[model samples]
Target: MEDEVLLTLMIEDLLAAEGFDTISAAHETEAMAHAAAAADRIAVAVVNLHLGRDVAGQRVIRALRQHVPNLPVVVITGFDSEAPQADLRGLGGPTVRLHKPGGYDELVPAVLNVMKQVRTGAWPEEGRRKTDYNV
Candidate 1:
């Protein structure tokens, strides 16, 4: 999920073109609704660190996980450092991170790679890249 409408749509289209369906949400409720509604269908999640101006980003991840246990997450942020969002680290299951403006180049691979890792149960410790953001 991403807060900016255009970026959310862009990411949706990018994934759609790659033959993946996406649920785009900018707030925790919308994300939870999607996760609860399509728990079995969701294969992975690419979440924006700052979901919206009022939402706590970590809440979004937590909500998603409540429905989909061990859900592979590709956490994305625009910040250069992750010191402020230290809570995002050590989130359960296999999570991977990427910094914007990585564009689709970095996103597609991260999404696919994380899903592959989770499915095979071989998420590399080396892929644990993190960054910071706020809501």
Candidate 2:
């Protein structure tokens, strides 16, 4: 949970209560490091999309996936409109993007669903497509 304020703390607390081992990071560097070190050990990642101007959490997702490509990343968005959902979904990984203010109950199920999909090898591979776009 590498977020500055608001939902990060709440989500972390929720995860802890659910009996999951958790860690926190407030920026990109720390998040990447944590993900790398916690690879295989971490079953799921609950990431917030807007992690400052540079899309830091997106970087974390890429790096973590490089380490564990099949890793399930549950993207959290605070946007009021549905526009970001499409963009977030196209991030090309095993993911679930939820719009807020989504409750902890909803959050936990979303996280657990992705984790279940991952554990059962039921998730779709990121860039696999039927129609290839050749340059």
Candidate 3:
């Protein structure tokens, strides 16, 4: 999971504690590198929608999708809103949009569920579309 330092570390720790082998990135460039190097090992990406830069997260997601279309991405944002969540939902296939300041327990289930969908080729509860949403 590649993201800014703060989110990267937080997610890494959480996932690591949960027994997942984790890698992290602070921005799109590094995230791509990480993804490239660990292509087969990474099961999913827990990305922060805002990387404290100009659409860095969006670019990262696009690149990841191009390289590994089946790679599940769960976009996490501190800001919670229906529009942004709906926008991520527009991104077709198996991606999840979640709000932070919630519980990591919630995140765990979301991560597990999305990855399960990817592994099993199952669609999420609601069918989603591929659309660009500003985080």
Candidate 4:
């Protein structure tokens, strides 16, 4: 889920152009609602790590994981998903992160990468780095 309207619209249009059925959510509650309604159809999720001032996207990710245990996540954030000295490893399932502002081209690839990991059962591997979120 992304809080930025322009970015969300850009992403929605871009993904739609690529023939993806898009679902957009701006915050935790909306994310949960959409996930609940379309969990089975949601093949992957692209979330903004900070929805507004809080790291609410993390909550969305966790909730999505609880709902769809092995759901692949594509986390887009301005800061590092693996911040220095930060520890949030059990964040759940196959995941990916892409630095924001100019990584539009990487979106599809990152999503595809995580989906492949799910398909091949390669994620949640031991000793994998946190930034290993993205391909």
User: How many pairs of residues collide in each model?
Assistant: 0, 1, 3, 2
Clashing residue pairs, candidate 2? Answer: 2-25
TM-scores of all candidate predictions against the true structure: 0.84, 0.76, 0.77, 0.83
Q: lDDT values of the candidates?
A: 0.76, 0.69, 0.68, 0.78
Candidate ranking under TM-score, highest first, comes to 1, 4, 3, 2
The numbered model that scores best in lDDT is 4
Model 3 over residues 1-135: C-alpha lDDT tens digits?
434466567777878878988877776677889767777777788877666464566566766776677678887776555654324533445777777667445777888988988889885554433343212
- Looking at model 4, residue 80 earns an lDDT score of 64
- Candidate 1 lDDT by residue in tens digits, 18-133: 99988888887787788789889888998887777753566777777788877888888775544576357646757777877764578888888888987899867553544321
What's the distance in Å from true for residue 16, model 3?
Answer: 1.2
Question: Residue 16 of model 1: what lDDT?
Answer: 92
TM-score, candidate 2, is 0.76
TM-score of 4: 0.83
Candidate 2's residue-wise lDDT over 1-135, tens digit each? 546676677888888888988777777877888888888787788887666554566677777777786678887767643453335432445677677575455888888888888778786556554321111
Regions more than 4 Å wrong, model 1: 127-135
Backbone clash pairs for candidate 3 read: 90-129, 92-129, 92-130
Weakest 10 consecutive residues, lDDT, candidate 1? 126-135
Residue 51, candidate 1: Cα error in Å is 1.4
